[model samples]
Target: MANNQNAELLDKARLLRHDIRDGSFTGYTSGLVPGLVQGNVVILPKVWAEDFLLYCYLNPVSCPLISMSKPGDAMVPALGADIDIRTDIPQYNVFKDGELVEQVTDIEQYWSDDMVSFVLGCSFSFEEALLRAGLSIRNIDLDRNVSMFETNIATAPSAKFFGNTVVTMRPFKPADAIRAIQITTRLPKAHGAPIHIGMPNKIGIEDLAKPEYGDSVPVNDDEIPVFWACGVTPQVAIRNAKPPLCITHVPGKMLVTDKLNDELAVL
Candidate 1:
């Protein structure tokens, strides 16, 4: 019954991710796998992983860790029974010396014995919840990546990993924004409530139209820009850490997990 239906839905999402890895599908994964939990992937050397884990613990709002694999373990059974960290994600961004060097669908060639993979909760799961509650996510409605920017808000520092938090913005009317906050607050694993609302400049975001990452959605006159701490914030920390090598899922192309969105609800 209910479990079987959930499994079926997750299977479909896994298939979609498989297609993405095989090049049959290469696009933003938002709204594609509804009801399933999607995640931001971070693969780093075991040497750097401990500090990164501490960073997540310190800044849970932006880096809500869902699961982590042992050094060199590619299969994260906790996320999906069949998940292969090397190929399960839709896309991966490779960074060297803190610079993005390339983007690829799979990372089998790059996998190392010292590598460890981490999966963090993504905002997409909560956005799905909002949609189910009859709230409109401007970026989803416009078929774009939610606007993201580097905020002035600093994350709680972990040794060797410290940077300003990055936030994703969605425009909603005042009432809808308040309701959205309430609904999202139930899912802390997926960013929970927004960090700031109504004032973009107050957060150090100069122009909402020019986002640091992802596509920009038009903000209607009646709506205000509401911001949520983003999973991508870790990438900013990675840049600050300047690890010899780091890998992450390309923004908007998350790892679809077997877990249900409802299963992650706090209340």
Candidate 2:
């Protein structure tokens, strides 16, 4: 029975990837594909890939490395059998000289022999675990992207890759927030634990409603905002690194992989 359920989930993920590839589903993938691992993407030239690799190593909590592709190789079979880094993601941000130049559904035009793609562990990979723990995820419940912000907290730098950490926020009552912390701690590959519990201002986020990326959700008066180190941190790094060319998934629209969330959990 468990095997049959897993097969069904895998089929769902493949279908979703097909829709993304065909430009049929160009939106955030937060609540969709429960139990499957989702990823954050960064595609760059071979010259810049090494530095970015070092950067991810330095900031493992914020930029946990998952599967990476060979230069000019658009396929990341380790993440999913049919993933084409250039087209499988719903949306992509094209950057030139550290500035965002365009947002597109497919990056086939930018493909080159020197381009390397990196897939990083996303917090969404652990949201299923949170749900299993009976935690109500506000963004998912509201059918919105998770709220993300650029914080004052700086990430450990490597070469030219340096920037403040970006984080995802979800508000919860105090007790539930504690439970969330415990539940998420078991998934270090998916950004293990909360970096900050409350007081958004303390982390340089002035307004919870005005996040730097993704959409904002309501926080009730009784709930406190909980912040987790986000996979989007690499975007800020890309801006600072000034790579001549870089391609990344738009903040909330992620690469849905066939890997199960439980496969990444620690005991």
Candidate 3:
């Protein structure tokens, strides 16, 4: 029975990846494919890969490294079977010299032998745990993208990579917010626990309605906004590092993997 269930989940992942690859599902991956692991992607030339890797090492909460591919290798078997970095994600953000050049559905044309791919754990991996704990996630409940913002918090610098942290926000009542902290604390790879519970302005976020990335969800009067260190922090660093070329998953859109979210939990 367990084997059947695993097979079913793997099938779901493959189907979703298929839709993403073919451009049928070009939207945020927040609430879809529950129970699977999703990732934020970063592709950089070999020359800049080491610095970015070190950056991830310096800031584990915001950029938890999951699986990295060999230079020129587009496949990440550790994350999922036959997972091709070039075409699996829903959307790609092309950056050239610290600026966003374009957004595309795939990176096949830009992919090359000198490039390396890195997959970082995403908070979407933990939303299932929150739901199971009987908590309501406003963004997920509304089928909208989670709100993300650039914060006043500075990340540890490494080589050319240095920037303020980016974070994702979810609204919950004070009591449910505490339970969310307890639930997510077990999944560090998925950015465990809340970094800040309220006061968006305290974190350099002036207005909750206006976000740096992803869609903004409504915050209820009785609820406070809970923030989690986001995987998209690398994109901010990529801008500061000013690499000649870089590729990342579009904010809110992610690379879905066959690995189960349960695998990332600790205790």
Candidate 4:
């Protein structure tokens, strides 16, 4: 019965993803599709892909590569059977000369033969694991996107890609933070473990109430801020690289995949 319930939930989530892809849905997919794997999307010219792939390889904690598509190919068979790169995401950020120029729900008008698509593991996958362990996610409870920041930690450089890492923060009591680290450690694809716990200023963040990206959620007086390596780190690298054209999903929006969260477990 438990398995059946999960299956039903997966079906519902899959349909939601499809609706978003087809232009019927245009909302953040935070807790709507529970138990399904969500991914960060990056599309770049083939000329830039090699360095980007290497960057991901060098910084596995922040950008764990889940799947990549052949240049000009719109489908990622490993993620979902009908996943179309140009239309599968709820929102896209169009960057020109390292700055965001526009936001769109579909990219078919911008698709090109020289483009390559990348799907990176998102922290949402591990949120399912955390919930299974009976830990609460503050952002989910508050109906907001997870708070993310630009950390002082720099990623290992790879050719044109070099920038500071970006991270998402979730507050938990000290005991819950430790358990979150252990639970997330089992899912390396979704950013393994917390990079910093307790001290936000030590990581160069000025205030917990203000975030570099996504919505801010409150932290209780007794809870400590726990930081995880976020997939958004690649966007900072893209900006640094300054490619002629770069595309990525908007901060909270992501590509919902067919792969099960358990399939990504390391142990």
- Please write out the lDDT profile of model 3 over residues 46-153, one tens digit for every residue: 999998999999999999999998999999999987799999999999999989999999999999999999999999999999998889999888889989999999
Model 4: residues >4 Å from true position, as ranges? 1-6
Q: Model 2 clash pairs? A: none
Question: Residue-wise lDDT of candidate 2 within 1-267, one digit each (tens)?
Answer: 989999999999999999998889998999888999999999999998998999999999999998888888899888778888889999999999899999999999999999999999999988899898889999999999999999999999988889999999999999999999998999988999999999999999999999999898999999999999999899998899898999999988999999999898998
lDDT of 1 by residue, 1-267 (tens): 987888789779778867866778868888877899999999999999999999999999999999999999999898788888898777899999899999998999899999999999999999889999999888888899878899999999899899999999999999999999999899999999999998899989999999999998999999999999999999999998989999999999888888899989986
Residue 7 in candidate 1 has what lDDT? 71
lDDT, model 2, position 220: 99
Estimated TM-score for each candidate: 0.97, 0.98, 0.98, 0.97
For model 2 the local lDDT of residue 177 reads 96
lDDT of 4 by residue, 24-96 (tens): 9887777766677899999999999999999999999999999998999998888777788898899999998
| Better model by lDDT: candidate 2 vs candidate 4 | 2
Candidate 4 lands at a TM-score of: 0.97
lDDT of 3 at 23: 85
lDDT, candidate 3, residue 7?
92
Report the candidate with higher TM-score, 3 versus 4.
3
What's the true lDDT of residue 236 in model 4? 96
Q: Give the lowest summed-lDDT range of ten residues in model 2.
A: 76-85
Off by over 4 Å in 3: none
Relative to the unseen true structure, what is the C-alpha lDDT of residue 21 in candidate 2, on a scale of 0 to 100? 86
